[model samples]
Target: MDDSIVFHGPLGELYSQVKAGKIKTALQGSHTRPCKFWTAMKILSGIKNAVVITHGPGGCAYGVKQAYKLTNCRNSGAPYEPVVSTNMDETKIVYGGEKELRSAIREVDGKYQPAVIFVATSCAAGIIGDNVDAIVDKARPEIKAEIMPIHCEGFAGEYRSGFDLVFRQIVKLMDRPTPERQRQLARSVNIVGSKLGPERTEVDTDVKELVRLIEGMGARIHSIIAGNCTLEEIKQAASVAVNCTLCLDIGYAIGTEMRDAFGTPLNSTILPYGIAATEKWLRGAAVHLGMEREAELLIQREYAAIKAELDEARRHLEGKRAIVEGHDAVKALSIAHMLESDFKMRPVIFNFHPWSTEARQTSIDYLLETGLDPEVLITKGTLKFGKYESMQQTERELLEYLGGVDPASTVYFGSSLSFPPVPLVDLNAILNRPRFGYRGALKVAKCIKTALDYAARPRSWLTKQIVFPPNSGGLSSAQSLTSKLAQNLPDCTVYAQRRKGRCMMN
Candidate 1:
């Protein structure tokens, strides 16, 4: 109801907001977001030859499987085994679904013959007090596949906690090494924080780019924690010299646990978006294994290759204002770092919820390490609705915000769903594919240069007609679908746009 900009300030000020209960004020509903069961399924199903037996209603099982497993089939480049479920219903909820769960787990293992079977509880199972661990304990010895029971009851509401839980469960799978084996693992490092694989984190190209850097330093990756790794590799991950967490938010919890569990030192910061972050990231990993010299040489080589591209892009982007949104606080800040520190642009990050930022403190810790501080904005759209409506509102809000500012000099750097009166930079463009290390800096420079070049021209006339309101100032002179929706014809506007292929996902 209160559709206004919620807050804006530096990172420290955002922290103050968190302390002041702004985050609590924003996140006030139980069903506001998907529960941890869905998140846990997403992580577990990413594992190679893994099966997840959901102990919940058919709806819960289907929703999570369709969203996490079935959809990711293409993204992961590996077909998923069906997500099995106990199919708990109203009758089972009143009694207990333990019988159905035990049968589901055994049936999944026998039919799929997977390497691991993760028996996960849904909110329904938690509500009904199904003893999932007891069922798993009874069934583990009899099952052919390695079986683990993950308790999802305590982490019902928040989805992020699921990532933390699954990764910690993975820590239980590692085999402790003798002191000699630990010494042998000096050049071996494990990459933590990735989902069961590459689909959830950075794209495939980005992951490979990070791998290139590590191998360049002559350090062997023991394994990526569940990211294209085998169960055997996970068991070997503990003996590694260090754990390099690609994402601190998801990785920090497991990283610290591994450090405490195996005495494997954790590099808590390795986001590596810009030159500084990448250099720092490489140094952080290399220093632990005494490979700093090799890292420095590789850095020099990377700098030599990227310097010209970086300089040329900086020439065009310096002093330009950038608006970044769509990503979480961690990733958005990393992008801001790339735009400001690497390209000499002023950055404004938007839509990063205070709760998510506060909960993922390690990202903020890295920003502090670099002393890279920037302004952050929170639009009313962020707290107002789900993805689809928030996108529409955010676009209108972006247009309004740009109309009030220097639209010509400002650029939006986020989702392509937005059509603000400025240069558009599609983050997922192929030119920006491997946006991770030194080479990625080159790709990013090219991406921005292309965007700025495109902005110099008038927008596609079709885009103007469909997105901007008729007679709008600065950019266009046409009534858009957004303007039509402002008059309460959302259904008609959406249908018309869909007919024209303007609203459909590519």
Candidate 2:
């Protein structure tokens, strides 16, 4: 609930009611949860000798590569290879490119004898009607290692769709593993819900802390799903006693399926984002595993350490407003609660898209319990302000419509978008820098302090002078004269000049 959470225009008015403690519920419905990218990152972190090969054009491979690199998993020593399908021209798309796909597979296998290869399809390949599964099926028998086809075409749906498809394919591969190998010395647990790119330092640290709490309760983590899971570890997942799913998307499904198939129980919970929620999640897991005493002790220690930092963050950010945007609604909700509870920030508005039932319920429960106004909750594509038509057009629009509006005190938490004039405090970067745990909380506190300090600084003349350039009408001397005049006369109206010159002020 930082100062930046308020929305303007029609949505802004509704948010004001919510901020004033009015209770209202708008459209409430169920939605499917998408895979959390952090879960994928976690799997990638634990894996060794496993390679993730994206099947599609160069952009597909590049996106995956960038995601991996951003997560800092590259230094973790996991074998991830991004493979682009042959550049298909119009003929290939219209006719078919099975031959080219087969060749791409053969060439990749020859070069990197990866224990397992995940071939993720691209939007182009998907439209071309290529049977990626068929190609992988034919090549699987010939290859020395496992070749899994992931139907993660860009245009397949949302990121959630890609996660679901990838996980389903992974589940299929899990069923076909070689005979059970000798169990490693320590008992294992599968950590699900990591995505490619920089680790969510706050969430990751929290997860690790949760793992420690579990360990204190006499449980051990076998392997993390996508974060650090290698092909070999994934195949051997049967050995784990349980799968702890943190993120709702890929992790929950993978955990539930693994439980059914391998007889491993699945524990689903909102990832630990704040002190209260973190303790609740830890206790829930402990009780499920019959480790109440240990859970108590672990919570005691974690809370003691976290309380000081939470107090500090609250002192600095309390009563401030903020906007939270991300793929993981659960994470966003948890963040909202933390801001409201610990930092005393008021959540003026919550904007998200492709809602899921569970996510909606969680948000609803929190709002109801807190007596939050329903009008402040806007569920649609990313928040837009009515500028930049292209942003409004994208399927996964971030901040397309954000323009001139003051949040008094604001903080923007999420990935970067073309719109939204305000700067973004990339959650991915923040998470990666200080990831989840007691230390992570401290790190977040520091980040909050920095952001608050920066936000409080007086605006400079240079900052105010920056503006979007006028489109069309050619750069006229009159336009230059108008700009110069406007700069000198703070209250000068440029609209009249722009209209006189027939300039398009985009």
Candidate 3:
């Protein structure tokens, strides 16, 4: 909150400063945020049997496919589908790309015959004013399949904008319900705001846990909006009685649209990470449906199932300083809140970007309202990394922050990218995933216990050298080996001499 541009206190206080517009985007133009085109494809990939046609050069299509499609298929139960493009070139750009876009849509419909074909515009398409919607409308009459156009130009807005753009489109597809049908859906809920459709990373495990809780309370889930759902399912989204939030940062736009359009209620709760939060998540909507007792029973049963593991993890983790980190501001801070209140630890947040905080202000405001305003610490290194820059500075910043702290009493909860000199509860481990509800709580406990139990184990020197090099030092072990190898050769040339430290290498 001061000119130092560094803070080490409650998130609520920091968020207040953020809301007041005091926090500037650090090292502008340095955020490695994905563009709308890439993010739009991420949403489309989650829908079953949908095809996306990029209205740009081939590289845009290929880059997005590699970044979202393949990984989503591997992790989120999505199918592998190639992202095609109009292949907009200079000639097309000079005249117009509409003809190419129309052809691409029809070709895709003939070849794949997908349930939905989303024509996502790129920066080039947007710049050219390609009239993507008009092209889609014309192509729709010629093709049998439904054609939709997403103005997902990379330069149009933040990566998060892609989410709402697709979500609003998804909401628009909803079919209205009769009064009787709406009443019958009084106990039904729609899980809104998904990135990977149905069974993707967060969708698979986290949503499964939500299913368990909802069914246990005698409630039913209508559909997970856009998560591997079919065209019919999206149209039926309006029939749900309540829309339960998976993450309001992405869900709020869809949730509000459904509310206004169909008069459906929305449960805009933060993600239920721990015992208490999960309880709150359930009650946020179930109580309105007059299922308070049922929700309580389910909570008690689930808590009892994991009581032993929770107690054990807490015994080892209590009184420790928890360092929480992630690009996801809400999820990271939610974990921090759980560690503080549930596990009895003090959490210090790190590397949560200010722009991200601004984008997800609604979620952040809700967290503060729930009294979860933990301290946040940011460094210049966290804000200034480009795509190819080494992440050693980030690690060094963390090490500096922990300089005088006790490693034994400190635990790091984040991705496996950083090799902190302390016990690290690796959040990226696939086995301990779905960090939601009681299932997540159990997995988190086991992971924490393991990380602390194996705190004495040595890190792999080889991977460490590749991932995080020394900031200031002589040659590393690999370099030293190369130097020795160079020294042994009698026919060493100028390049070899440079490698052996006999001369400076450019």
The RMSD (Cα, Å) of candidate 2 is 11.0
Q: Which is better, 1 or 2, measured by TM-score?
A: 1
What are the per-model numbers of colliding residue pairs?
A: 4, 70, 7
> lDDT tens digits, residues 1-506, model 2?
12334333233344345546552433222222223332232243234455555444555455545655433544444334543446666777788778887887787778877777666556677787788888888998898877776565555554454555455556665633233432441244566765543334434455566567667667677666665456666677755545666664457667777667766666665555655555665665665456778778876777687677567666877766666653455666666655565566665434543233233453445444554332243433333322211223221222333434453366665432222334334444442333354555555555555555544333233322332223422212232333343334321111222233221211
Superior candidate under TM-score, 2 versus 3: 3
**Candidate closest to the true structure, highest lDDT:** 3
Off by over 4 Å in 3: 1-5, 19-22, 27-30, 74-82, 198-204, 386-390, 471-506
Candidate 1: stretches off by over 4 Å? 1-4, 22-25, 28-31, 76-79, 196-204, 386-393, 404-408, 461-506
TM-score result, candidate 3: 0.86
> Candidate 1: deviation at residue 245, Å?
0.8
TM-scores, each model vs. reference = 0.85, 0.65, 0.86
What count of clashes does model 2 give?
70
Question: Stretches of candidate 2 above 4 Å error?
Answer: 1-48, 51-59, 66-80, 175-187, 197-218, 308-330, 341-345, 350-437, 442-456, 459-506
Per-residue C-alpha lDDT of model 3 across residues 281-382, encoded as one tens digit per residue: 898878656788988888888889889868877798888888888467778867886787688888888877777677778888887887777878877666
Evaluate model 2: give its lDDT: 0.51
